[model samples]
Target: MTHVVGESCIGCKYTDCVAVCPVECFHEGPNFLVIDPEVCIDCGVCVAECPVEAVYDEKMLPAEQGEYVELNARLAKQWPLIVQSTEPLPEADTWAEKQDKREHLMEMS
Candidate 1:
């Protein structure tokens, strides 16, 4: 199964996961990142690089964060990836603070 990026990563735009992905499945969203399941090699590199521990295998995804499995697949179908960010980004504080916002920020990225 491919890796899925979850809620803990909702607003934390850390690019570490993007850098390590061999297939470039990590795509940036407005508030988080999405993984393209079709392209993911299932190598788990992105999961290891994620600072928030937000990346997980689709089969290993937590029950509460299950939506991310679909989210990752959908976005990967669209954006696919961002190839050039030169650094490990700090946590996106604004996104983290919006605990109640209901908009699908990942889709808008």
Candidate 2:
């Protein structure tokens, strides 16, 4: 299974996880990142790199965050691939611990 970037990443958009992904499966959007399930190696490397604990193994994803599995798959196809780590959003620190931020997600980079 692939790793899913969930709500915890919506506005925080930290790139720490991107730096550890061996398969280059991450896709960048305006304020978040998604893993291309098709390309992900399921390495679980990104999970520990994420400061916000946004990345999760598909099978272990919390029930409340299940929708992110599909969201990651769909957005990965639309957003550009992000192979290297970059600065997070300016408000990352402010949003890192915030919950229910899915409605704040932007579709474009």
Candidate 3:
């Protein structure tokens, strides 16, 4: 398993997490940031760097936020290849509170 980003990261789009990620697995989402499961090393660096506390490990994530495991994995597969960075900020603002009304997904996972 790996770490995941949730609701707290929505419109926040801060790049603090990206700066600490050694693998640079985080990517710029239309609104928020997403982790690349395919490359994430499960180091948990991004977790501590997150200002809003939006990052969580797979095992620590709450039951309600579990779906984020699949969401990040699936989306990462679809995202185009990007140059990994030590700290990259999100580009757009597709986030709005609960963009998809699945705000619970932000609680832990």
Candidate 4:
């Protein structure tokens, strides 16, 4: 199973998870990141690396965040690959505490 990046990552866009991904499955977007389900090795290392707990195994994804499974797959194709850790958004700390930020998700890198 692949790990999914959920709405919690919408504004925060932390790259901690990306650095730990051995398969370079993570994709970079303007305000978020997504896992390429087809490339993910399902190692689970990236899950704990996410400070906002945004990454989850597909099967363990919350019911309410179920859409992220497909979202991750779709977005991964459009976004650029991110294999290194980088600074998060300017308001990452503030955004990390907020929930339901799906509406803030940006589609561009």
Candidate 5:
């Protein structure tokens, strides 16, 4: 199984997880990030690195956040690979604690 980046990452776009990823599984979007299932090592390193607690093991994902598994796979195919850490969006702090932000997700980078 792979780790998935959930809705909590919709606007935060924090890349702390990316920096610690051992594989090039992360994909960058306009204001989000996704992990390519095919490339992910399921290392679990990204999970603890996420400041927003957005990363989760596929099986451990909350029922409400289950869709993120597929969302991450689909978006990973469209977005570019992000192998390093980068500054988060300016409004990251404001959006970090917000819930159900999926509608705000940008499909394009």
Candidate 6:
């Protein structure tokens, strides 16, 4: 199983999870981060590191957020790798607790 970055990470884009990933599976986008399923070790370290609770194991993902599994996998290959923690997007705190953020997800880094 691999960890998926879901809708909650859309506009928030917190990098805390990236900081703890041992396998460097994280990829950075304009307003989100994704996990490269092929590289993820499934260690679950990123789940707790996400302040917005955006990361989840494949089996643990909410039914409504199921699309994120493929989203993360697809986007990871298109975005650049993120091996270190970095400042979140401006107003990240304001968006962190907001729900239904899938529409806000950006496609570019």
CA lDDT of each candidate? 0.72, 0.91, 0.67, 0.92, 0.92, 0.91
lDDT of 5 by residue, 19-108 (tens): 999988999999999999999988899999999999999998899988788889999999999988999999999999898898998997
What is the Cα-based TM-score of model 5?
A: 0.96
Minimal lDDT window, size 10, model 2: 100-109
The reply for model 5, stretches above 4 Å from the true place, is: none
- All candidates' TM-scores? 0.79, 0.96, 0.71, 0.97, 0.96, 0.97
Count clashing residue pairs per candidate: 1, 0, 2, 0, 0, 0
CA shift of 109, model 5, Å: 2.4
lDDT of 2 by residue, 24-90 (tens): 9999999989999999998899999999999999998999989898889999999999988899989
Per-residue lDDT of candidate 6, residues 27-91 (tens digit): 99999999999999999989998999999999999999999999999999999999999999999
lDDT tens digits, residue span 21-106, model 3: 77768766554577888788998988887766779988888787777788777766665433443332343233333444464333
Q: Select the stronger candidate by lDDT from 3 and 6.
A: 6
What is the overall TM-score of model 6 with all chains considered together? 0.97
Task: State residue 76's C-alpha deviation in candidate 2, in Å.
Answer: 0.5
Quote the lDDT for 66 in model 6: 92
**What's the distance in Å from true for residue 83, model 6?**
0.6
For model 2 the TM-score comes to: 0.96
lDDT of 1 at 56: 92
lDDT per residue (tens digit) for residues 1-109 in model 4 = 8899988998898999988889999999999999999999899999998999999999999999998998899999999999899999999999999988888888876
Candidate 2: stretches off by over 4 Å: none
For residue 83, model 3's alpha carbon misses the true position, in angstroms, by 6.0
Model 4, residue 34: what's the lDDT? 94
The sequence of per-residue lDDT tens digits that candidate 1 reaches over residues 1-109 is 8888887776667788777766676777666778888788899877787767878988999787787788778777776467655443355655555553335465653
